[model samples]
Target: MLKGITENAVQSLIASENPSDIQFDIVVIESNKKQEEYAYPCTRTLFPRKKFGFHKYFNLGISKTDSQYICLANNDLVFHKSWASEMLRAFDADPSLVSASPACSIHHPAHGVDLYSGIHEGFEVRKEVAGWCLFFKREMLDITGKLDEGFTFWYSDNDYINTIQKHGLKHALVSSSIVDHLESQTLKSKDEKEQFKLTHNDRFYYEYKWGKRSLFSYLNIKRKLFFR
Candidate 1:
């Protein structure tokens, strides 16, 4: 986990899970100013950080991971106790499955909760994969390459999912696996401009990828907005 120094949510997640079974190596990437105070036994990377964005953080994490199966998750996501086991089973059942995501429901009322009901079904390539919790085989890295660094703010997950589909890889949601997502904890938008920019980025990604070429394209946009 390449967690930012300010992420207290990581501590909450660590406290919730069983230390023995779910134990894995952690790599905390912190700002240079926080290097001394946040230091722990786990691997640490300190940089003169300045708004590197989500894609950059993801790339940094991917570079550090050597495991065959890698999970890229937000620090604010709280996994169900059996999350790891269920995800493992899903992956084992189908080697072709490039990515597996948990059934996530929003934690904060401001983020809205009912938006997630019955959203995790039907395995298809064109569908969006929520970045909050994504588990995938390392082979995908070799195939689809890294998240597009051009996406400094939003739609990085959409770009990745599109790349995965282009490579003919499959993805599914582990219906039994659940996660409580404290949505947008780290990237909270405090101004209208930030919110508008995020929306613009999302729309740009959709238009660039789909381009109104098919009848289903509009439906895809609606599905992503309402369900994904």
Candidate 2:
């Protein structure tokens, strides 16, 4: 399912609006040797068998690009042709908007249909943008540094949001941009024991790095500030 989604996503981008105007590259990151054929169509495909951490792969990809703007996308997303252009327009609209994301219709764990409606109705301001389909200037990376490698997986996006906000940078949800996300499609399929160990370790590492009393403490604050 994940491989099929990746292929479809690549096809969608190839078929998206104004393909000639949007000069971009697609980088696919995977762990299995058998997946090389699946990722071969991309501009560049990486296969790192070891558990080098999520942020490491992100940084590796970013390091390979010289584009002014960078978008970190997940494999489970189905992007429209206008997606890149819409996100670019948001950055163009406000110089201070350092990072942005499209309002997803089917964000998992919590459906984002309402959030999408609100954003589409012109209420796009957001405290922390999800990493699922995130866009940002390269300068933000220069300022805040690469996504904290310590995060490995969980809370990395939150860490990014907090870091940039502390530096007076801003983020938003680009209402016009759109993507259909099959969220947690891969992670949900993982063995429960492995998933639990990774989740627990990452949560503790995140709390330690951010000085949180507990995982719920961070969630409690985010719920009030953003969900409200």
Candidate 3:
């Protein structure tokens, strides 16, 4: 499968796996791009028929699917052969595990959550996983509820971690469930200045929703954001 979330990624997902119970509900935020039909029996939605922030799409997708296990994945990912099986096994092995994300050795530095590091393989409990792909049981919604759609583009992952922690839930990174994330591969509809402004604005909202970060901490994140 293609490594980045794109139209071809859906086709690749279908091509990689054998006939199974898995289903896809493709949600496009804006309808400016051309749409095509997939061979699989799936639903498609052009939400708001316009561009919006990330969490809104995910919330809408969850509402549209009734699967017991839902994987909120970005379109740009290359699913290794065992990705699905390993993720499911982690949940099966730990009934208390409420959420998970497949591991990527090359990580984009995440702030505000303690995570397991230096593992080439195996499952490890974590405070959070990168937001690129988050998998969890449907019932988790009962406790954590839908992702806070207020996170227009950033810090929703941190908010989710806070939610999981508040509810005494465990989030894990399943190393064997490998999915290569194409980081920042999604097309940016906004210009650089506007994107930067929106990101900082989101950070302020994050602090307001959670708690304040020190000046140094905010500066550190700013440096990484600029360089990354």
Highest TM-score model number: 2
Overall lDDT per candidate, in order of appearance:
0.61, 0.69, 0.65
With candidate 2 superimposed using the best TM-score fit, by how many Å does residue 74's alpha carbon deviate from the native?
0.9
How many clashing pairs does model 1 include? 0
Candidate 1, 70-184: lDDT as tens digits: 8777666676667766777777777777787776644322333233343343343223355677888888888778877666556666666767777778887666566667667
Q: Relative to the unseen true structure, what is the C-alpha lDDT of residue 151 in candidate 1, on a scale of 0 to 100? A: 68
Worst 10 residues of 1 by lDDT: 107-116
Higher-ranked by TM-score: 2 or 3:
2
Error of 2 at 7 (Å): 1.4
In model 3, pairs of residues that clash are 4-76, 5-75, 5-76
Candidate 3 residue-wise lDDT, 96-171, digit = tens: 8878887654552343222234222213223237577788899999988888987877776777777888888888
TM-score of 2: 0.81
Q: List candidate 2 segments past 4 Å from native.
A: 33-38, 108-128, 213-228
- Model 3, stretches more than 4 Å misplaced? 1-5, 21-43, 105-128, 187-189, 213-228
lDDT winner between candidates 2 and 3:
2
**TM-scores, each model vs. reference:** 0.69, 0.81, 0.74
Candidate 3: deviation at residue 49, Å?
3.4
